[model samples]
Target chain A: MARNPIRDEIAIVGLGSTGFYRDSGGRSAKALACDASIRAIRDAGFEPGDIDGIVGAAEPGGPNPNEMSAALGLPQVTHFSSPMPVAVFALVDAMNAIFSGSCSTVLLYFAYTRLPWNSRSAAEDPFRRHHTLGVMPAPESVNAAAAYAAWASRYIHEYDARREDFGRVALNARAGAARNPLAVMKTPLSMEGYLQARMIREPLCLLDMDIPVDGADAFVLTRTECAREKTRNPVVVHAATTGLVGTNDEDQLPSLRRHGQHVVVESLRAKSDLWLEDMDIFFPYDGFSIITLGWIENFGWCPPGGAGRFLEEHWDPEAGCVMIDGRIPLNPHGGSLSEGATRGSGHIREAVMQLRGDAGERQVAGARNALIGCGGFFFNSQGAILRRL
Target chain B: MSEDVDDAALIERFPYVRIDHDSKHFYRGWLDERLLFNRCDACERFHHPPKPVCPSCWCASLTPTEVSGRGVIHLAMFLHQGPPAPGVDYAMAAHPVVAVELEEQEGLRFTSTVIGCPREAIRIGLPVELGWVERFGAPFPVFRPVEGS
Candidate 1:
């Protein structure tokens, strides 16, 4: 029988993670990444020397992309970019490389550590070195926060969203964390405990957010036919895309115009020909809990005001949430809230794990169709949908 | 002697003109606290973070409009890390960062803070009134959730 060309195409054959850690045990970012990559290559039943193409998510204070290429001792790299939402970008880059015949096998890697030795004290640091090290200074300056606060104040006035909703998101994640061994905040969170947490920014409390975590994860991508030769089962890359509308300039859509239209959701729906209901698992980026609500609404799971209700209804354990439907699991690996942020790589690694059917105890049964979304700064966003062929 | 005095004074000052992108000739000189925004006649849209040009129409035909000083709480988060300099006490109670939706503007959203109350009381969807504090030669806008509303 002649095979369907698209059905049996590019596939992810191997995956590895250094687990999620609050600290890296004193290893440099490259060292941590190397550890994960080596394991991934071996997991794919290939040797370290077998990889021809390498890609990575950009990390602050980590090895540069060129340096990683030199360290890996690859003959040449077909493609690379440190785009925000790194994991998806890395996968997209690898796909392009394979299609263009640049390299058949690719290694994608990421790592970070938050141990005190690995962590820098914010107060003692002069000139805020870590903040300045990234592509741009951290956007948490008083001016920027003030700008966001102004917007938050307006959102309160218009949409009638309440603090309880934000609290529910954090509490739910915290509660979910208690069940997962990988979560940093594994302690059970009470409403009173959440309310008592010191306020950082008005209307936003410490418990209402995720802390930066240190860890590493990697994956190997190759042509589906070649991948089938290596692994028992291969997850196919059904589709991948990234979107950026306006430049970083403040004037493009400004605050008013940008709020109503969600470009990321619109773009993904157009490209995939799948509705929110079609996805078996959702890995929407939760850089901020409020952002998750935005994703839920934007993805058309519910209308604008429907996110709070959706969470309240689906979060019940005894009732057996209908949203997941035994197939449509939402972040069973605890997501960024529980798994720690490997930058955007965390979400990608989770998707890969589910597709490979190796997500272990947290695995969703027969999760054939999966969706992942990543958003950056003020409007840069991307998404990819994958399937097990 | 008079010539020397005149030169000294002139060196310390220079003539300058403030350019306006929108026809909203609104300016504050730090006397009274007044909240204002710009409305575009072409698109019939209002803008916060008050810019000279209408964001929607990109036209200079913007007119100054006074706001009701009331808004709805949209979304809120307490960011512990990555705050910029000029740090006051660690807790920013709706002072530096908060998200708000205006009561008057249908879809306008602005990120600011609410002040004049304990930080713990700020709730979502709370009705808030605009407040201001002048510092470093500008009036910074903050919000205070309306009491007993």
Candidate 2:
């Protein structure tokens, strides 16, 4: 809480992303990153040379900051890094660079191709490998689904939550995506369909998982004053923080197993002036339905293990929940479940769009503030509070 | 499912032990038909999946202690499908993966499969007992429903 100087000091002035798809075979991850960067810079009313800093969300085999800078033909990039795989970590880095007077404008982006099922990238997860006791990991352990399934199963046990409860989260995501043109899964997801879907892991149906789509999303962050000059709707960074507290050192897994939202959000709440009620939209990272549930509890939106009842009573797949629309919308951009997994950028961009009033069909009316949650599966937690200025 | 190669190849690809400095003793416990966890000599806290240093007290001194291997299923999932990967072809339809909170420790849990019971019968909080199964020529820890409990 000491010296919270970065609050409202930085703003997102521009945003751009490649069209989401199941498999964008023609483009490499670098190409997607470059394209998104170019469009985002242009959207911010600047060219490649105008960007003095760059931060990239870590992607497997994706372009680093230097590669992206070279590809974008940027004349100078004083601050450049792509060290972390977590998306929110990268965004926070960009905000820090601007806050520290290290750079004026920062380009932040994440890009990746949906590797083929037979591809090695599927087993490239460092967490699974590390947790596997240095032995060959079970195929289930190799995929993120296993980790989520572990969490979901634990959630179900502790809360007596049902698959139907988690199903609602997926149902709402698909419903939101049906309205989003950039979303990959457009078809309606019903409870019946969700229940009938093939189980990827016990407690986790295929619908409960995210589609690894090939795409890239970019955002332009600058000083609040400069952002206002660049664009009429500059989304102010209300609060941003990242840390590994209560997470394992080796695997970076949450120390509490199925809990991390409190650790991340509590730190964020300490730094921000807003409460759960002040936000217009909630994009608690939907890497898993149970994760979103954790965020719901950890943020005091509902009590711990009460997310099922809260969601069942609050969320409606048809008209969109009054909780999401009237009170606060959750993942209004269809989230990672339906929206292609642009890491957390898709969530961040959707929050950005909602705050800017540019979210055509999914816009939260008179939106002012948005809360974005990132990184729980990796045990690390990152959060951001954005407000429309 | 076994067409690609043999059981050995499949098990090697999806190993149960990484055989690190901290975990070698833990896997050795499996070979001895015992479920072992790292017990911090300083704080007396139990660490699952074997860590070199105690997570609670940050003490490097630890010992692998055997447990009764009786646990309650903290959570359970049935993997009926899998991702498309050459190494992942070993997943059988309707495989039950359970996170069992060992009775020895309050929150100590590990990812293991539940066998000897119908996959549908596996539920969270179900009492389970560790049962060793030969996987890749080594004793791999698996769980089964503890009857009458």
Candidate 3:
């Protein structure tokens, strides 16, 4: 393995979320962040003074760690940073800081608000009018969100894949979202409905992409020893990592076979003692359905191009989700696709909830471990495995 | 003409893209209707979207060399809706975008729209060659289907 001495040492003692909404009723990203942060601090059985480390995701229009400390009035902080978004960067940062004793407890927060470009409501809101992308991107380039569609086309060509393969991912998420109150998209999705949705980017339709919504998710991480005192069944991070390749440029990426996700799988597999067989829940990020397929294939659940078939073979029509080997459920909390794109925070938070046996109706019976694959092919590919202590 | 173009003038030419010192040569090439990518002066390797130093050899010396811009389409997508561009009418049809793998090196590619081709005809593995279209009154590199391919 990869010398994961920090394994199982850091525990996510508390988690809080603002649920998710297509609109936050004119709430700013900072407001959403503060709501989640306060709940997480209280959930951890501590006041603001007990928090000595603050790690906030540097999401677009998000409050920075220093700003959060000022707003929440955290008495003092020894470690603080604003890591780039997609969730696991802040997660790994906070976990490492706790293990290294930079701070005993860290408030990790992710606040997401739809930018003007993506959401019409956000664009019309006068408060959000100041945010700009600076340089206007040409419609022709394969960058950011467009890259997934570009790559999905390549995937079909290389593997003879079908849109049906991608649809099942959406179908699964929608099914789960019907039961998850935190999800913004609760309408059950069918493969036919997926095909009929408006084509935002060809090969990937509106349903194939995650919905942009205003929300925040926060976590309180502390030493496992500290967590054991308050909660007997605390969720501990067994392994967490972020991965990248040198040629990460969207158009210049090597191929569909290799990219950031591949590196994350290699790193996570080495660091983790638990593998697929031991997992009770799977949370492959559905930022784009193509990403979920990448995670399924790259994680070695199936061959390079077999995620679609793997999902089909293991699909549970009764539950309307994929039940791997008639047991493990994929993204029981609906993931980013239906759960309103909390980046990967929704995935991590759901994992912790499932491990704590607090997922209510979505809870997996006797759940012990959860595996999460976050982000996508180019950059921000990350993975985490959480275990009940 | 490209050499005469200064950083400020180049920035004005390609207003849609963010250009810095390292990528200035790339946009300068666009003014003269040429496609340039950074080449490691030491290892004689090529890379695109211009980086400060050679990623292959970590060599400091590099040159923005022009290429034939001939390659096969590696990836393709159509945008039913996207940002506003002068010639692109998404309502008329879904705009097509493609990443053409340059023949100079494996896995090295440039992304742009393909011209002189119907929507249905554009596909991965189709042969394409460099073409230019004026955008904001400056040459913008694009791809067109190779004749008889």
| Model 2 Cα lDDT, one tens digit per residue, A4-59 | 78899899988998878865656778888888888888888887777999998767
Residue pairs in collision within model 3? none
Compared with the true structure, model 1 gives a TM-score of 0.71
Model 3 per-residue lDDT tens digits across residues A1-389: 78999999999988889999999998999999999999998898999889999999999999999999999998899999998988999999999999998999999999999999999999999989889888889998999999999999999999999989999999999888888888899987788898899999998899999999999999999999999998787899999999999999999998888899999999999998999889999999999999999999999999999999999999998998999999999999988888888889999999998888889899899999999999998889999999997
Instruction: Give every candidate's TM-score on chain A.
Output: 0.84, 0.90, 0.99
lDDT of 1 by residue, A96-156 (tens): 7887788888888876544332246532343223444222222222242233333444445
**CA displacement after TM-score superposition, residue A7 of candidate 2 (Å):** 0.3
- Winner by TM-score: 3
TM-score of chain B of 2: 0.79
Q: lDDT rank, highest first?
A: 3, 2, 1
- Model 3 chain A weakest lDDT span, ten residues long: A334-343
- Per-model CA lDDT versus the true structure: 0.60, 0.74, 0.92
**Candidate 1 segments whose C-alpha is farther than 4 A from its true place:** A1-8, A113-157, A175-182, A245-261, A319-327, B1-87, B91-94, B98-149
What ranking of all candidate models by TM-score puts the best one first?
3, 2, 1
Give the winner by lDDT: 1 or 2. Answer: 2
Error of 1 at A232 (Å): 6.2
Task: Using DockQ, rank the candidates from best to worst.
Answer: 3, 2, 1
Tell me the spans in candidate 3 whose CA falls farther than 4 Å from its real position: none
What TM-score results for chain B when candidate 1 is compared with the true chain B? Answer: 0.64
